[model samples]
Target chain A: MTTARAGALLDRLGRVGQFLWSGWAGLAGLALFAALWQAGHERYGDFILPAPLATLAAGLTIAADPAAWELAGQTTLRAVEGFALAAAAGAAGGLAAGYSAATMRLARPILTVLLGVPPIAWIVLAMIWFGSTDGTIITTVLVAATPVVFVGVAEGAVTRDRGLDDMARAFGAGPLARLTTLGLRHVAAFLFPALTVALGSAFKVAVMAELLANTGGIGGALAAARANLDVAEALAWVLIAVAGLIAVEYTLVHPIRSEFERWRNAARPWGVKR
Target chain B: MTRETTDAAPSLTLSGIGHAYLGRTVLDAVDLTLAAGEVAALVGPSGCGKSTLAHIAAGVVEPSRGRVARRYRRHGMVFQDPRLLPWATARANIAYPLRLLGLPRRERRERAEQAAQRVALDRADLDKFPIELSGGMRQRTAIARALAIDPDFVYFDEPFTALDVALKRRMQDLVIEAARGARFGALFITHDLMEAVRIAHRVVVMDAHGRGIAGTRAVPGKPGGRDDGTVYRLVAGFLSDDPLFRHIHDIDERRTP
Candidate 1:
């Protein structure tokens, strides 16, 4: 038992080392993107597009202030709250639709209508309903993020292995046991990727709604920069928003997803390693 | 005079079992019984509804008409494919049914390891995922999973049909040995007469149209006791001369219900 436990620990450590090592490739990709940004800045001039280094300096200056931190934190909190609600509602709805044919048929047309309406349109509607507050930003984020998660989870549920279900039944598993053990585990593969997409949109829509609703967040800071024609400061706020997204995606979403998908890594060839 | 014969009771009884998929009838008026500690190899032609019958008997499919009575304490099953959970490690896959039964984690682990050892699966291979294991090892893990439940009866639905010749023989030997040691009754379903003659105490052939059981032939000796020459001769003789096995080799995939 001790040896088995040790082996599992070692396996986990190896995967963690591999994950950290893969950051080099991520950094290289980022550097390439920076090179493209620099080329754009040099061509357009500072007034049109600030240089990457100048933006970083401005972002650092903003980061030094305690008030700027609150602005960033307020936006993060709104986006994360909306994302949590979306995940819960979408998963429940998707699981319902996936297991029942009648529910799936009904949900499809409604989902189509939901996806067909633009996030901007919903933001306008939410602004009218909830006014210029956190409510407006959160409502817009929920509308934008829920459909992505719902579609992914529903598809996951629909395509589950019937053979496995039969195998489970033959072993005397009841419906509830089958659902918890097999159905949920199968759906998780589809859930994580949908969550990543939904999360990305959650942050994007939160920022957009904050700007339109005139709530005091990074969006409000951006509005101030726009009023004074401070292009570098606006770019710096955008940089900070993107940095928050990266931090949350890496620290929260990616780690949990990797833990669930470690078996997939074992299937990969040794030479490919990724 | 009344006699107490609890030991002589059948492990399973299926009476007038019938099934249909959509509107198409796949099985009709089928009845089968398995006595305690008897390994019955059910053989039939392709598309003969043999698998459907197995599924119905195992309660994986609800029969359109009939009754199924299982007297065994608990049961386990192995399918044609390994059916090991791809996202789980081999050890976890073996322990899956135990988890379903709500066994404590420690006992689950111990039983899973013991089952693995019964199938001669290497201890190190238990940690690997289904994708990491070879075809033979994966099937072995599946068999181990079935054994882990400590079942009094088992259902094997063409469990070794996917393996190569040598691997198939090895798996058959493993099942034979396992059945001998565990003394569990089993309903072994396969289309191969040679396999049926090799592993089963009695070989049952189903009707071509799945109307009913065509006939049954008792093998001369216990499974794992018969020599290769005896098994080969019996299969050949049945194929060439036995009227009951005339259509056992027939294949029509389009006719499968």
Candidate 2:
């Protein structure tokens, strides 16, 4: 009955509409990518690169098998677990580094070393340590992805809006409250980008580690397909891993990230007409 | 000469307040005082360190060379920017200080709504994020947040410099109305002489380079209900007669994009 209630409902609806509209844009962009893939297929032919439609058929056929589903599930679980652990450790380490100068000085060199070392090297070490198990895959993913997240979050903390911090201090906000409200939120800006990179790396490292360690996952399936010299099956497994990564990104990571970033869409250029 | 001390804390007192950046002096020997329930406006040109003084007076910045005293249970600061957390709703932003005070969720929400009402922010606007609200609305949210804690003192550091003429006056009225019976003192910083004359009990002028006070003009009667003509006349007298108010207009002109 009240206008305020009505306005609130309208604003919520408007936000939902904006979200779906952006989703459509994302789909449209994917369609363009599919079109490019189809062009590549036409040039390279079926042996080198399958047609987009043919690849879709192959992926569907592979998905119909329950064993393939189990393999896909294993790979997804490894990637997600590794990402979760890395996120926790990296965010904690980065916040410490950001909040304290001594930590930053100590961490900067170590992070640089970790980041500079290749994932292949880590996967090789994990294979020697854990010996052909999920441990090898998860360890490789964590080592590969943690520094990426740590660097992003640390930079975000360092560059947080000091003006906002002053405003908070004036309002009698204690140290902990300020860290949660202003400090963490500022880091959220950088957190999402780092997560995107970490997510991709998690999947890549998981698969690479699995293939090296001969653990059971999509990577194993790809190795089997390669041994059989079956181009379609190998491509199908690759497509399945990518789809899984994308699903987790959309369903898990993105919704939370969008909540924090909704404010960014509202900052418009001055003097620009609506 | 104004190295003042009091056994009991007054609203605010600063003497011989000076600041410098990397051996370059930005302010020197600036003295100011505000009584409880009184509002004093510090008017100066841009870069004159009026803001720096407001910061020192509010204890946000330690004066490089001065003794400062503040006797207030709680202090509020309204920055030039609203500085609302973009991720937070207006209600959340307004309730932020109360949350710091460790009030319950329901009580904080209630106080936030009450403060929003004081600033004439409708319930609908309270639910909007700072970005969704207009610039004036954001500033009002900032004001509401500042007043929600019921502070004994407020430092308004050029908080109304960004509003349109109509919005600016409305906000000024909200401020004066809020301060009327609250008994909270305020240090209002501005480069606008008319604005200072309209809202402040007294206006302290800081000249360029911020070395010392150029002049202090006491506004007759209370802050509100003074005729626009009277305020205008007083402002005109300052511009021509006081060297400090002369460049007040120049600061206004140079920064008017």
Candidate 3:
């Protein structure tokens, strides 16, 4: 038993090593993107597009200020809060609609209407209601992100294996037991990708709402830089915003998603471990 | 009930069971009974609603009209697809019903291991997911899952139809051995006369239109006692000489009402 436990630990270490080793590919992709930015910088000159290194330098300068960390943290907190609310609400609603034909019929038209309204329009409405507070940014982000999660979860629940459901029933599992044991696990596959998309939009919508509502965050900094016409600072704030997004996605979302979908990795061929 | 009376009562009984899909009838007036420790194979052509009947009997489907009385203490089902949860390890899948029964984690693990051993699944393979296991291994895991609950009655819904010939034979032998050793009653649904002959004490044929059962024939000996030659000869005789099997292989996809 000790040896088996040791073996499992080694296996986990190897997987972690593999995950880190795969970072080279991500780094290469980012390098190619930086190279493209450099090309654009040379073509348009400093005013239109600053060099990638120069933007990085400006981003570093902003990072030196403790106040700027608060700004970035503010935006991060709002986006994460919005994402949590959206995930909870969407998953609950999606499960309801997925299981009940009547609920699905009722929710479909409402979902279409929600999706039809642009985030900007919702931002404007939120600005009037909540007025330059975290609520406006969070509300806009919630509206923008919820539908994506709802649709993904619903699709997951709808496409769940009836065969497994029947198997559980035959084994004497009650409705609640079946949902907890089988239903949630199946829905996780569909839920993860939807959550990734929702999180991305949550951050984007939060920034937009912050700027429109005159709330202080990365977006407000960008507005200030725009007025000053400091293209480097504006670009630096943009970079910082994107970096924040990547950090949260990798640290929080992707790890949780991978945990849920570890079986899918086993399904892949050995040569295609990533 | 007393142990004597319980032993005498049928493990499962279905009477006047009828089912429909939307408005179309799929099963009608199906009355069947399984005595204690009896393995009965219900055979029919494709789309003849034998699967539906099994589902109804297992209480997985609500029949439009019927009464189902399950006297068995507990039951398990093996589906045509194996129906192992894709996300769970083979061990976890085997332990699922036990978990539902609120067995402690330690006992669940112990019983799941024992059940896996009965199906001849490797201990190492228990940690692997369904995707990592071969088709045969997955089916074995499904069987192991069924066996884990220590059920008195089992529902086999074409469990080995997807396996190749040699593999099918091995699985059949596995089921035969499991039934004999465990002494659990089973309702095995299948389209293969050879399979039915190999694994069951009696073979029940369903009507083509799902109106009701057509007939039943008792096999010559107990399951797992017959040799290959006897099984093959009996199946061949039934296919060629028996009127009950005349429409067994018939299929027309457009014939569904």
**Reference-based lDDT, residue B165, model 3:** 98
DockQ of 1: 0.82
Best-fitting candidate, measured by DockQ? 3
Task: Quote each prediction's TM-score.
Answer: 0.97, 0.84, 0.94
Better of 1 and 2 by DockQ: 1
Q: Cα lDDT for residue A102, model 3?
A: 95
lDDT of 2 by residue, A1-274 (tens): 3786797689778766766667877888889999999899889888888887888899999999998899988998998899999999999998898888899999999988888888889988988999888889999999988998999998988888888888887776668888988899889889998999999999988988888788989889888888898888888888888888788787777777766776665565543311
Which sequence of candidate numbers ranks them by TM-score, best first? Answer: 1, 3, 2
Pairs clashing within candidate 3: none
The candidate 2 chain A region of ten consecutive residues with least summed lDDT is A265-274
What local lDDT does model 2 show for residue A67? 86
Model 2: residues >4 Å from true position, as ranges?
A1-70, A100-113, A266-274, B1-9, B15-18, B23-31, B65-67, B207-215, B239-257
Q: What number of backbone clashes does candidate 1 have, counting pairs of residues 3 or more apart or in separate chains?
A: 0
Interface RMSD against the true structure, candidate 3:
0.7
Q: What lDDT is obtained when candidate 1 is compared to the true structure?
A: 0.91
lDDT of each: 0.91, 0.84, 0.91
Model 3 misplaced regions, further than 4 Å: B1-7, B251-253
lDDT of 1 by residue, A39-89 (tens): 999999999999999999999999999999999999989999999999999
List DockQ, one per candidate, in order: 0.82, 0.54, 0.84
Clashes of each: 0, 0, 0
As for model 2, its CA RMSD to the true structure in angstroms is 4.7
